[model samples]
Target chain A: MEPQNAREKRDAAVEARVHLIVFRLGEEEYGVRIDQVKEVTITPEITRMPKTPSFIKGVSNIRGDIIAIMDLEERFNITSAARDSRHTYTLVMEAKDYTMGFIVKEVPQSLSLPLSSLDKAPSFVQDFNISENFIEGIGKYENRLIIVLDIFKILTSDEIMELKS
Target chain B: MKSREQEYKEIFVAEALEYYDALSRHISELEKTPEDEQILAEIFRLLHNLKANAKAIGYLVIADVSHKLETAFGMIRNKELSFSDEVVTVLFDGIDMLGELISNVDGAKEIEPSPALLRNLDIIINTQTDNNTELNKVQKYYTSKNLSLSDLIYIQIKKLDHLLNLVGELIIDRDRIVSISKELDNDDLKNVSAHLYRITEELQYSVMDARLVNVGSLFNKFPRIVRDIAVAEKKEINLEISGQDIQIDRNILQIITDSLLHLMRNAISHGIEKADVRKKNKKTPQGNIELSAQNDRDTVILRLKDDGKGIDQQEVRKAIVQKGFLNADAVSDLRDTEVLSFLFEPGFSLAKEVTEVSGRGVGLDVVKNAIDSIGGRIKVDSKKGVGTTFTLYLPTSIAVKGALLCQVEENFYAIPLMHTDSVLSLPTEKLHEVGNLLVTDIKGETITVVHMRELFNNDLDTYNGTKTALEGDVQNIIIVTYNNRKLGLIVDKLLRQQDIVIKSLSRPVNTIDIYAGVTLLGSGKVCLVLDVAAITRYFIARR
Candidate 1:
């Protein structure tokens, strides 16, 4: 009975674990599934595009394709009282059809959390006025709360097009 | 692999559409000159070939229609029946039916010709219903030699587009390797690179050549379209088309076909005045529209000129103010060219009443966009009472472009050399501010100038390490011309011209109008290709 219970616990843990890449935007940490992140590289020189929103940092050359780069902090309107240092890393993300990059202030780390540890974002999220559906849930790791993001939702063509206009 | 039936159906549809086009053209010509033996023989031959091919493919409806049409033409050839209004009407109806049925051939549904059409044709030819006799006659005339397979084969254009894209990537990599070999200065590597470059050049040429189609294939169809539009509008338009053998990228022809048709419709309905009005204006009662294409160096120049009522600047200005798009003061300040450009603006119709052909106000803008999509430029020239001409300059190919690289501040931008007229150096002080526009005299021709530094400096505060290009005493001005309008753009430095492969920007970023597409340099840095035509149009509209 003891061996069977141990095996069941191991199976549950294996099935429930969620791998994510955590990056910092302002003071809060955000996590997206590792599957959604194509690659992480030290931020490259981004060419600024004219007549686009401020959040759209510009485009970067990735394997001969121009991938649009975005400033996640500005995109989500996260305010940090202290001025953050220069963006040190760019996270390449795979959306439905194309790949894009998001610039964050620090190099992101990969970590796993049990699926059970994720809680639906608090109702007060409505008061914060962040874009609706941008976050999948809030994740609780040992002592930190990570805002789990829905990358596909954030990269929805309709919302991006809206931001364009 | 396709089924044998499917393959035959494809052949049948292609041949049927060709036959329909030929018949329509000949029937229209026969209306004007009823005694042209050459046209008469051509029509009969096309119908005969179409009937045999369609019958073999089991497309019985098309075969039946072609057979009846062929019988009528045979009677005409035998001098038993002559050209009549009824004969022309029945032949046109038959051609239209063939086109309609051929388009729906993919569906495995049975098709039957309209009884009225068959009845009308029967009355013309007085044919007896003798299917076996007709089949024997067709078998005799259509020899086995006619059915022998040809060397030519049909290739799906999508496959060609995919191949072209792959070739574009290979060219980019080839360029990169060439640059790296040059930097290393290794003799063997340099030789190998040169050979590779030559081979890639030939391969690129062959791929591009495979996609070349005679412009006549597209131009031949326009006469029929023009005839239909003229008949609907009760207008007499003499469409003079030339340069039929000029070759262009097949995709470019496909992209511009509809836009050309739209222009033709606009010319007939709006640009051309009524017969009575033309007589009163002392112009020819029969309006003339010349559609011609010619090869211009590395580009194709297509001109559509109409001797119709040109755009009235005063009327456009009045409409601008009346529509409240701009206040009267602003409209008054606009130059005549600027006022004329409003005609291309969406929903900026000058027509007093919406006509079926045009003036629903959604045509010229779409036409402009189609031209832009193919990396082409279109310009309209009008002389009020004289006429209007829309001249389109299109790149011979889209995968590769000849671009002149220039630097502004710390970034690099490529200006398509086709649109670029000349590069000049001038003192910064030569730029004079004329009512909010910087105008400079270039050999006594006043040219509006804009500094690249300020034009692309919208996000200055958000980014760092960007400086204005006007720090020195002299400025590098590249004069770009679109239509007859020219603009002098000042840059910091000029770089060597290169053959760049342009990769279109994916979503969100593609909406930016200032940059056409981005190309990677030898140093792995991506440079934006400036949309010179759009920039010129913007400045022209500004003035």
Candidate 2:
């Protein structure tokens, strides 16, 4: 009986790892662990801080606290689509020790898939060089390569320190 | 629609309060020096303006009182009545009653002046007939003194605030030229920049000067506060005020009033020793508390000092432990500055018992919070059994100039340069991973690294798509300090630095809290400005 309970616990842990928050950026959809997402909000006024990395959009006041906003289009080397009044949404996620904002092309949707279902990207993917540090693995979903993100590796220690400060 | 009416009422209330405040000061000045024709004329004009505004607003009771006050002032203006201490006192009494009526206008309760106050007013009017000769003599005396009565006008504080704000916007516009010149890289641009710089500097100075108001307007209420608090505490205290002519922003002046009043009350109740104690300590029986303001560099330093037994550090330490705020081990390592700061901690009090006066333990914390909310710092210097002095250092203006704009993922943010510490270009080689966390050393301080892209949950593909690193020599890092804690943020680009006029984000955007305000750059693109303090608090709370 104890062994069966232990197996159930292991299964639950495995189940929790399957779901991801997937969102569109430029023309591509990317996924991050669902657990890291805080909330989605409308893009707000982003105050620029001096001497930050080029990809950081700036910072915004969220409620009474300030949170950093990052420009995914710039980070991913994609040309920003012409901003219509309704173009972007702010995806708030807990990264490192702070809540930061990401500008995305569209609102994100959540999806669930077993970890075993994910397949490694083929070596021939053209954009693999720039995304090498960011993508953990690619999963086949609806005949598309859904890049799974390894968020922890996206920024260096100094960059993280800069945002934290 | 309901909110609109409420907003109008608020405006009316604010206007009414200004009239009351002016009336109080004018009446006090008249009482002190009754022969000053200029002051009398000023008082008359204020009453007339109040009467007109009250009638326009349909506040009939206030209008009626204002009309009567105007009539009374007119009699003095025409030399039909004499200036006397008794008459001045009656005028001050009427002003006080008007203040109460104005303050209570929004409340459901109806307030009426006391019978005694009414009787005094009647006496003042009745005395005018017999005092006609004395009035003539006083008018002759004033004429001999060559004092001319100046017509008075009442300017709404809101209008003044608006004017100041417009000036602030102009300053930003002027600052943008400097940035524009840097981008153009031409002789014509340089000439235009030099020309814009001079004109803007002059305009900035003149506009800043316009916002400068004499601090006496704030100090006038303190004497009454000290009197009330001293009487309540059964203490003998004399309040000394200096540098009343020193000018500061009206907005800042308004904010500091309540905080200053609280400090004065605290001084009377806790800082000023009792008469017996003072005598025993070889000090004067009547304690003296001095409140002074002076300009120090670009900051205004207001100091409140009292000669009394200073704060007991031991008691503060014990209070910290008693409140369960700190453990024994932490207490042992605490410095005096840290202990002093514990007074600002919410719900921490050293008072033995809650008193109707100062011992409630809420006053100091509120004072500290008020000062901090305005980006001001408060320092408490106390010598045990000697005295205590609280010095507040505040920026001369709340309006900021140019802000540094940076991008994280695709979102833009601005940081006010006034509060900005420094910006560094982070080298990848210096980044180190500690366990699962990234850390970096900056100026000998170990700082945590935050990934801009991940924190905002930006789609990795968009980030990767924009991964073209600028052909820059090094990656940039922005270091910002909010409340003394430093944060370093990494961003994708260092865009053009320009002066952007901060426009407050409306409604839903405001609710987000991370953005302080929005501004339009030279190209008229709206950008979000970051609230550094809010971001810092958010980071700390999440950590």
Candidate 3:
């Protein structure tokens, strides 16, 4: 009975897979879940927001909500483009109680990868300044490696506090 | 499946509290007039409702308790048992037990009725069975045909708050439309804009009206609190309330509930004197305490007055000195009003010993803090050996305000009209240089001039100096009073006055206290509503 129960547990583990929404930050491609993507649109004019980290570009007036726009390149250690550049789109993402925008170089696309295709992020890839907790196991799609982003773990509570304070 | 049960239990608990409050109210009425058939029937109906609700929720223990109480009430309804205080008190205890049983459904596990409580309820039943007339006395309540149409509907507060938020957004859009129509200068667009403005204004008023709640609902609870304290303290006191019809925002009422509780407790614990002391002082042994509310303009004034021993400034002074809060020399120059304000200072309890009721001096400051949080002020007045009255002044609503628009450089800021005294163009030549600061004379009073540019202190550097009002020789000054002192805010222009919906600055923006909140101006630009009191205090402290 014990051996059979262990075999079922292994089967469940093998079946675990994460569906993600992949987007580009400069030359790098990253993936967050499609579930958390509320909208994808051209980055509009943003208000000059203060009391936040430099990674926070500004606030976007979407409908009536004043959502913060986080610059993904600056957040993930890629050199930032000029904020007013046209080569950018915003992904309105949600995780638990928080909802904010992520500015990426390309429009996000949805995809799913099985657990068998995923592997631990290479030590060099994890060397970015961003918190490694948000870097889920990496996978390859169409011969291009995609880094999975854990939406809930991307920004630490302390970082959110800085944006609010 | 397990989590579903947890959600149901939460619903049952919330509903049970409302039912319990209704039961307690109806039962209290029945106690006073036990022979009133209507009151008895109402109490029975309330119990029956509780029983059926508990049974449906699978809280069988609570249902059993309610059933037992319902049966006893049925016997009384048949005119079999004589109305007595002993019976009323016993049933009140039973109701209390039922309350405990309802609270015990914490969603963690199934619970059973206490065997001891069941036996106690059984004993009451057996004692009353001797006079039982018939077993078929299920009292029929007032029929549906006899029901009066109640105009009141209770919605969850969150719904109204959400509606208010959407209305706020609509108002912002309306202002943007008005600005656009004025720019286009088209008669057709202007006509539509005028109609839209009128309808939008009416909607704002109607929504605020829906949120208004009568102060009486809160004041009604005070009599019971006073009665319980009076009985416990062995004192004879009467609480006479007037202006129970005064209505204010329900949010403000809920915020001040704890403050009122503290004040009432203090009234009984310290404000009212003992019977012997009253007799020795050649006064009536029975004391009178009045709780009243009156509306003044857009503000509500709640005054709780007790004709007990008024506060003694000498005793309070000693406490302040003893607490080492002030030096003896410093305390000597304090006025009676200033000394009275000291009672609200923390660590200054007048009660010599800790009592369950109050008097540790910890609560008075809490009362002041609570009132302040609701954008209200509390003032205490007492004449030694006569009486003490604490008056609370609260706003009708905190969401919207009529404000005077003012410009500092190019930026627009709002000053609440309630605090604005008068706007004047003071000639800079007439302004006397008192040391390093500017001062002016208005109506034979010295007013400190505060430069908005300097007071706001370049917090929003990007928006700095876009519009300057100080280009002329004369400075535009708005006279305002805070903490009995007058200060003048120097601005470049004074725009038209209008009602603006204020939104609280959530974070980083709130760190700058110069602005009370953020509002969208008629031109669609975000404006900060100034906190006059804070600016006044900050200027004075700097001086």
Q: What share of the true interface contacts does each candidate keep?
A: 0.37, 0.02, 0.04
Q: Rank the candidates by lDDT, best first.
A: 1, 3, 2
Put down candidate 1 lDDT per residue, B461-500, tens digits, no spaces.
2322122335777878899976556899888899888888
Error of 3 at B165 (Å): 3.8
lDDT values for all models? 0.80, 0.68, 0.74
Give DockQ for candidates 1 onward, in order. Answer: 0.39, 0.03, 0.09
Model 1 chain B worst lDDT window (10 residues):
B135-144
Task: Report how far residue B116 has shifted in candidate 2, in Å.
Answer: 40
Which whole-number lDDT from 0 to 100 does residue A154 have in model 1?
A: 80
* Model 2 stretches with alpha carbons more than 4 Å out: A1-165, B1-153, B185-194, B359-361, B401-503, B512-543
lDDT of 2 at B57: 73
Winner on DockQ (1 vs 3): 1
What is the fraction of true interface contacts found in candidate 3? 0.04
Predictions: Cα RMSD each:
10.9, 17.6, 13.1
- Pick the winner on TM-score between candidates 2 and 3: 3
* Comparing 1 and 2 on lDDT, the stronger one: 1
Q: Identify the candidate with maximal DockQ.
A: 1
Which window of 10 residues has the lowest lDDT sum in candidate 2 chain B? B135-144
Candidate 1: Cα lDDT at B322? 83
TM-score of predicted chain B versus true chain B for each candidate: 0.71, 0.59, 0.67
